[model samples]
Target: MSPVAGTVLAVLLSLVSAAGYALAAVAQARLAASAAPAGRGALRALLARGQWWWAVGLNAAGALAHVAALHYGPLTLVQPLGALTLVAALPLGAYCARRRVTRTEWRGALLTLGGLVGLVAMTGPAEPGEALSLREALIVAAATGLLIAALASGRVPRRRGDTGTRGLGHATASGIASGVGSALTQTLTAALALELPGREPVWWQTALLAVLISGFAVGGLLLSQAAYRGGLAAPLAVVNLSNPAAAAIIGVALLGETFRAGTWGWPIAAAASLVAARGVVLLTKGGAPAPEADPASSTVVVTGSRPVPPPRATELPAPLPAPLSTPLPLTVPLSVPEVEPARASIPG
Candidate 1:
């Protein structure tokens, strides 16, 4: 395809992918209401649910579509386009849950939209960088491993009284993993491009790249859901913000792509990113937990990513009182003579 056609195709594919992601997020949120605790048992229960399955399928489709888009267009261009998911999620949430979109959500969405516009406009043409080297991949792996360890350490936040603080931490940590996963997509695209000729060595390399990308993507998915269950707006913003940035960096570093950031480009991009981050914060603030929210179970009710509480015990009602004894007939048989009036009548 020509450059114009390729770019258009990439844009269209990215949009469809965004829609899929929105639907998946909605499905996951509903399943969360009945989702088991986060563990082997919960995973099993999650898999058993149709909504959960739908989410997996939709996200997988989105990922595949995303990779295809990257294969054709610049990562910087395509990555930022993924931000469409946030905007799409708003209406999807309303339709699926039959709830109204809050003003805070709209404000956040608007901010995200504006930030995306600025980010995309500021992005310059990308140069095709060299494919990811083995050393670089290893470095990425080590860094991500450490990040996961720190996030999972269960260290309490300094302000224990403030609810959602720890959850935000979890969201941030998981968002980083998502960013790495986005980078992996760019790497995969490069590897796939090298494999078109079908040489034996290239085939092996491509296979390796595929495995790596799959691993990271799955890991990202797990972390992302965890982040969602842990916190919504914070994690949502974190993922949306970091994922593209990470991909852009990878495109420049590993894929031989150039962003051509000039004297003003860096500042513009930075400002736009900050705007997007602020918008995400607003989205979360607007969707604050209810006053009577159970720190754990309430997560299942509204916060999409936060951990879902196990199915509440089915409440059985109390038994009803026994029926009153049956009443006797008004008329009595002569031989039965139930009343004392018979004795008085014989004496008279």
Candidate 2:
């Protein structure tokens, strides 16, 4: 197939993967909610769900389709197309959950997809290379460092009274794993194909690829579950951005992919990334926990009228008047009055 046709195929396959991810997420949520207390069977239970099985099958099909597309096109082209899964997963999750997704979600998802498509289209295919080098190792290491930093920051935010923080935590981990996974997959694939002159992949290279694929599958499952449970915008954005960002960097630095758009392409890509990030932040903010109600300020009904009952003899304010012209101020003074000694313990 031509490169153009391969790109199209990759995009279509990504949509299939996205649908699979959404279904798997929902299934994982259901199973997680119903899992046994022992926790020994949680993984099994999650995998046991029929919906989860469907998700796995769909994802595998997507991976195979992606591989086929890559054979015809480029990694820079194909990997970015895979980000379309985020677009597909959101609406699919909403529909399956029997909920109507908000306009904000649709806009965010679409913008994310558009931004990714642009970023990928700009990148040319990977250079045919056989083996990993020290320079590539250093680059991967730097990316990994950034990933770790993000995770640390996510944790700190959660610790500081951020109740909606789990989503961020989950997203961060997912993003790092997805990004590294995609990059490594590319590296492994190129190596195993014997693309490099005078080099061939040994048993370890094949084993490594197997491990990476398994990790990607499992991580993708949990991440999708977390994303669907948390809502699409943030998790999807993180995954979409991180995976391609990692892949794009590798494509440019190691695989020698480039864009004719010049310096502007870099900034545009960064801006698009931030836009997606803002959407996630907004989604997370919207899901924050509400403040607790103050029972003291609340009104209680003692017959027809709402009133604050007087304290008992043991308590202060015995036989307090009811239904006054104006409700007695429930405000608490800084200093307590000596006369109302028993009531002094309670706030004025």
Query: Could you say which candidate leads in TM-score?
Result: 1
Candidate 1, residues 1-348, lDDT tens digits: the string is 799999999999999888888777766655653447765787677667777778889998987898899888886678678878878887776677677778887898789767866766665534453445555665886777687668756653544333333345555555566667655555567656653212323566657656766776676666666555533444566666666566556655656554456667778888888888778777767665555645545545456576655554452222222223323443345446656677768978
TM-score per prediction, in order, is 0.68, 0.67
lDDT of each: 0.66, 0.59
Give the CA lDDT, 0 to 100, for residue 38 in model 1: 60
Q: Name the lDDT value of residue 231 in candidate 1.
A: 37
- State the lDDT of candidate 2 residue by residue for 113-175, as single tens digits: 766676666666555563344346435745665664566354324243354345655666666
Worst 10 residues of 2 by lDDT: 152-161
Cα-lDDT of candidate 1: 0.66
Q: Model 2: residues >4 Å from true position, as ranges?
A: 1-14, 29-51, 69-81, 129-165, 197-201, 216-220, 223-229, 285-348
Candidate 1's error at 181, in angstroms?
3.3
